[model samples]
Target: MKFRVLVAVSTLALTLGIAGTGAAQAQSIAQALAAAYDHAPDLQSALLSAKSSAEDIVRAESAKRPTIGASLGGNYNWAVGPGAVGPGGTNPTGAFTGSSTFSAGLSYNQTIFDNFATEAQIEAARAGAEAAEYQIRNTEQNVLLDVVQAYMDVMTGQQLVALRQENLTFFRAQLQSAEDRLEVGEGTRIDVAQAEARLAQGEAGYRAAISSLEVSQATFQRLVGAAPRNLSGGHDFSRLIPGTLQSAIAEAETGHPAILLAKAGIRAAQAGSDAAQAAFGPNASVSGQVGTSYSTATGTSSGLSGQLGFQITVPIYAGGALGAGVRKANIEQIRSEVDAMGAYDQVRAAVIAAWSGIQSADAQITAAQAAVSAGQEVLEGVIQERDLGTRTTLEVLNAQAELTTAREGLINASSGKVVATFSLLAAIGRLTAADLGLPVEVKTAVPYTQTVEDVWQELRTVAD
Candidate 1:
C-alpha cells in the first residue's frame, strides 16, 4: 500500500505545474509569470508611474508653444461737476462728464528665446521619463523573479512532504519488524522502543513538512495568482544565463536596468545644470493684443486697438539663487555619475555571487545524488543483513533514516539550482517573460513615450 502511494506521489510530482492535468487547469511557471505581470499591483503601479513621468515631457515641451487668452470688462462713471482738463488727451479742455467705458482684448505671448533654457528642460524631462521607463523593466524583473522563486518553493515543498511521508512509512514498518522480532525472542524491548521513537520522530517531521508545504503553496498562490497544482519540476534557467561569470558581469554592466537608470540620471542632472546656467543669459519674448470696445453713454463704437511688442530681459543678480541652483545641479550631476559607476560594481558583484551559487549548487546536486544512491545501497545491505541474523533492527532503522535525509538533501539541492540560475539571469537583466519565450505579449513603456512625443496628439488618453 505504501509503495502504491509513493508511486502515485512521484507521478504527481512529475506532472506538477503543467496544464490540462486535472479538473482544474495546472498552471505552468511561464503562465504564472505572465499572470503575475498582468495582475501584480506593484508592477501595475510602476507602469502607471512611468506613464505619469512621460507627461513631464509634454509639459516641458509646452514652453516652446504659444499661449493665447481673452478677457472683457466694463465700468460706469457719473460726474458731480465739470472735469478738469486732462493732459495729452484729444479732449484736453475737459473729458465727457458722464461716460461709460468698456474694453475687451485677445492677448498672445510667445517665448521667442530664453537662451535654450526651455530646450534644456525638455531634454531633462525626456531623459527622466526614459529612466522611469527603464525602472518599469526593473520592476518587471522583480515580479518575474518572485514568481520563479515562489513556484520553485511550492515544487520543493511538495517533494519534502512526500519524502517525509515515505520516511514515516519506513519507520512504521521498522517498528513492526522490531515488535515481531521481540515476540520471537530475537530482539529486546529496547529495539521496539527505539523503533517506536524513530516512528514518532518521523511523524513529527512529516507534519512539519506538510505545514511548510502549505505555507509554500500559499506563497505561490499569492505571487502567481493561482493555487499551485501539478507543478512539473524541470524548471531551469541556466540556458538563459551567460556561459561564464565574466561574461555575466559584462552583460550586467551593459544591460542592467539599474545601471541604465543611473546613466539616464546623469544626463538629466547635466541638463538641469544647463538650464540653471541659462538663467544668466538674456531672455526674449513677444506679445500682442487686439481689442475693440463701445460705451453706451458715448454712443460710439470704439475702433479696434492693437499692439505688438518685443522684450528682452538680462538678469543682473538673483540673490544667489540661480548660482545656487547651478551649483546644486552640478553636484547632483557628479553624484549621478558616481552612482552609475557604483551601480555597475554592485551589478557585477550580484552576478558573481549568483553565478557562484549556481556553480555550488551544481556540485552539491552531484554530491547529493551520489550520497542518496549510497544511502539506498546501505539501507538495502542493512536490511538484508538483519534478515540473515547479522544486523539488528536498530541498524536497519539508522540506514533508512540516513537514506531519507540524503533524499531530502537532493530535493533541496535541485530546488536551489533552479532558483539560483534564475537569480543569475535576473542579475544580468535577462530574466523577463519575453526572454523566457512565454506565449504572452510583452508589455513595454515605449508606447506611452511614443504617444507623448507624437506631433498630433488630439486624444490625451492612453490606449488600453
Candidate 2:
C-alpha cells in the first residue's frame, strides 16, 4: 500500500525529466532566448530606427563643412536686327549670323561664422543620437521580456496538458473500479453513474489542455523562430534579483533605459532652444566665385572675372517668426524636463509592480506545494476508506478531484514564479542578452552608427 501511494504521489508531484528520457537533449531557457534574439523582427526594427536617428548628427555637422560646386552655361543670339551683312549688297537681314556665348565657373562658400547656431544644432543632434541609443536598449529589454513570457507560457501549457492526461487516466481507472463493484453487488448504479460523469469531465479537461498547449507552441514558434521540443523549462533565477525591493526600485528609476532616454531628451531640447535663440543674433559668412565667358560672331569678346565677398545678416524684424520659434523651443525644453520626471515615475511603478508579482508568486508556490502534499495523502486515505466500505463512491471522487486541483495549482504557481522573476529583471533593466549571457551576438547601437558622422558625400547613407 505504501508503494502504491508513493507511485501516485510521484505521478502528481514530480517534475518531468525530459533530459533523462531517450529523447535528445532538452533545450534550455537560454538557448530559446538566444534563438529569439537572433531572429526577432522587433529587435531588428529597433536597430534600424537607431541607425536612422544617427543621421541627425551628420545633418547637423553639414552646416560647418565647405560647400563647393561648378556650373557651365551657354547662350546664342541672332545678328539680324540693325547690322548690314555681305550676303547681298546692303541687305542686313539676308545673311544668317549669330553669336554663341559660353561660360564656366566654380564657387565656394563656407559658414565662417553663424553666431554658434550650428554648434548648438550639432549639440542637439548628438543628444538625440544618445537618446536613440537608450531607446535601442529599451526596445531590447521589451523584446527579451516578451521572449521570456512566451517561453514560460509554453512550459506551463505543456505542464497543464501532462497533469490533465494523468488525471484523465486516474478517472478511467476509478470508473472501471466502480463498474466492477456494481457488477459484484458491492456498489449501486448511482455510484457507477457518478464515476461515468467524472470520466467524461476528465476527458473534456484533457482535450482543453491539449488545445491550450497547441496555442502556446504556436506562440513559441513565432517568438523563438522554431517549434518547441523537449523543453527542460527549468532555471535558477532567484539569485539574479536584488536583495531588497527598495534597491530594485532605486536601480530602475536611475538606471533604466527609459529614464536615460528621457534625460537625454531634456538635453536635446535645451540645445534646440539654444539654437533657436542664436537665430536672432547676427551671422557672418565669406563666399568666392570665379568664371570665364567668350562670345563670337563679328563682335568677339572674352574675359575672366573673380570676386570674394563677406556678408553679415542681422534679424531686426522677421515678421514675428523668430520670437515665435524661440517661444516654441522654450516650451519644448520645458516639456522634455516634464517627460523625464514622468519617466522616473513610470519606472518606479513598474519595479514595484513586478516585485509584488514575484512576492505573490512565491507565496502561492509555497502554499501550493504544501497543499499538493496533503492532498495526495487525503486522496489515498479516501480511496482506502471506500474499499473498506466506510466511504461512498462520491467521497473518493471528491478527494481525487481535490488532489488534481492541487497539482494543477502547483504547476501554475511554479511557472508563474519564473515568469514573475523575469518580469522583475525586466523592470530593473537587467533583462538583456548580456545579462543572461546567452550564446548569441549581442547587437548594440555602436555598430549601427559606426560612421554616421562622416559627411563628405552629398548623397550618402551609412550601413545601407
Candidate 3:
C-alpha cells in the first residue's frame, strides 16, 4: 500500500516538474499590455472624444472670417394702369402692362471687431482641446491598470488550479492507503471513511478553482482582446515604482494626467470669463451687397446697384443678461480653480495608497513563502511519523492540508505583489504605453488639433 501511494505521489510530482517546460509558447506581460492599449474600447472612445474636441477650435475661429451668400430668382407681375405723358400730347395715356423681372446678387458680411470676444472664445476652445488630450492619457492609465490586474488574476487562478490538482492527487493516495490498511486489518473503518471525505473535499476544491480560472480567463480576453494561452507568470514591475513616497507624490503633482486636466479646465474657464466681460462692449462689422435686375418694363441697367456699409452694436441695455453672464463665468472660473486644488489632494492620496499596497504585498509574500517551506517540512515529518505508527492518519492528512493552504497563500501573495508594483507606477503617472515602451502606435491629439486650427479653412464635408 505504501509503495503504491508513493508511486502515485511521485508521478504527480514529475508531471508538475515538467509543467513549465514544454512546446507551448509563453506570452509575456508586455504583449498583453500592448494588445490592451490598441484594443480597449474605453481608450478608443476617449481618443474619438479628443478628436471631436479639436473641432471646437475651428468653430471658435470661424467668427473671425467673412460669410458670403448668393441668391437668384425670377418673378412675373401683371397690372393695368393709365399712363399720362408729361408733354401734354392728345391721347397721350396708354395702357400699362406687367413684365417679368429676373435678379441675382451676392452679399457678404465680415466682423471687423468684437471687443476681442472671439479671440477669447478661441483661447477657451484651445484650452478645452488641450484638456481633452490629457483625458486620453487618463483613460489609458485606467485601462492599463485593469489589464494588469486581470493578468495577475489569471496567473493566480492558474496557480490555484494546479495546487488543487496536486491536493486531489494527495487525497487519492491517502484514500488508497486507508483502504489497503483496512483490508489488512491494520486500520478502522473510520480511517477509510475520513480519507473518502478528504478525497471528496479535494474534488470540490479542484472544481471551484477551475471555475475561478474560467472567470479570470474571460476577464483576460475582454481586456486584452484575445484568448489567453500559455501565459507566463505576471511580471515584476518593482523597478518601475518610485524609490520613495515623497518622490512618487512629487511626480504625481507634475506629471499626473488628472492634475493636468484640471489645470487646463481652469485656463478654459478664465478665458470664458474674459469673453463674458467683453460682451458689454460694442460689436462692429462690415457688410456689402451687389445686385442687378432685368425688367421688360424698363432698361436693365436702371435696376443695377451696389452698396457698402459698416455697423456697430453697443450694448445699451439688455434685461441684465450680459451682467448675469459675467457673474456666471466668474463663478465657473472659481469652481475650476477649486477643482484643480482638489485634484492635487486626490493624486497625493492615491500615491500614498498605492505605495502602502506595495509595502504590504511585499511583506505578505515574504511571510507566505517562508510558511510554505515550513509547512512542507512539517508534512514530510508527519507522513514519516504516521508510517512508524507514532502519528495518526488524521494528523498526516491535516499536515498535508496545511501545506496546501500555505502554498495557495504564497501564490496569492506573489500575484498581489506584482499587481501592487504596477499600481504604484500608475499612481506616480508613469503607467503609460510610451513610458512602458510598448510596441504600439500611441495616438496623439496634436495632429487633428493642428489640422483644425486654420483660421481660413473652407467648409468641407467630412467622410463617415
Best TM-score goes to which candidate? 2
Which residue pairs clash within candidate 2? none
User: After aligning candidate 3 to the native by TM-score, how far in Å is the CA of 218 from where it should be?
Assistant: 1.1
Q: For candidate 2, lDDT tens digit of each residue in 328-429?
A: 999999999999999898888888888888789889989987987898788888888888899988998898788778878877887787888888888888
The segments of candidate 2 whose C-alpha lies over 4 angstroms from its true place after superposition are 1-14, 17-23, 79-93, 236-238, 296-303, 448-450, 455-462
Candidate with the larger TM-score of 1 and 2: 2
Total backbone clashes of candidate 3, pairs 3 or more residues apart or in separate chains:
0
Error of 1 at 343 (Å): 0.8
Query: How would you order the candidates by TM-score, starting with the best?
Result: 2, 3, 1
Separate clash counts for every candidate: 6, 0, 0
Q: Which stretches of candidate 1 lie above 4 Å from their native place?
A: 1-26, 74-103, 235-237, 455-464
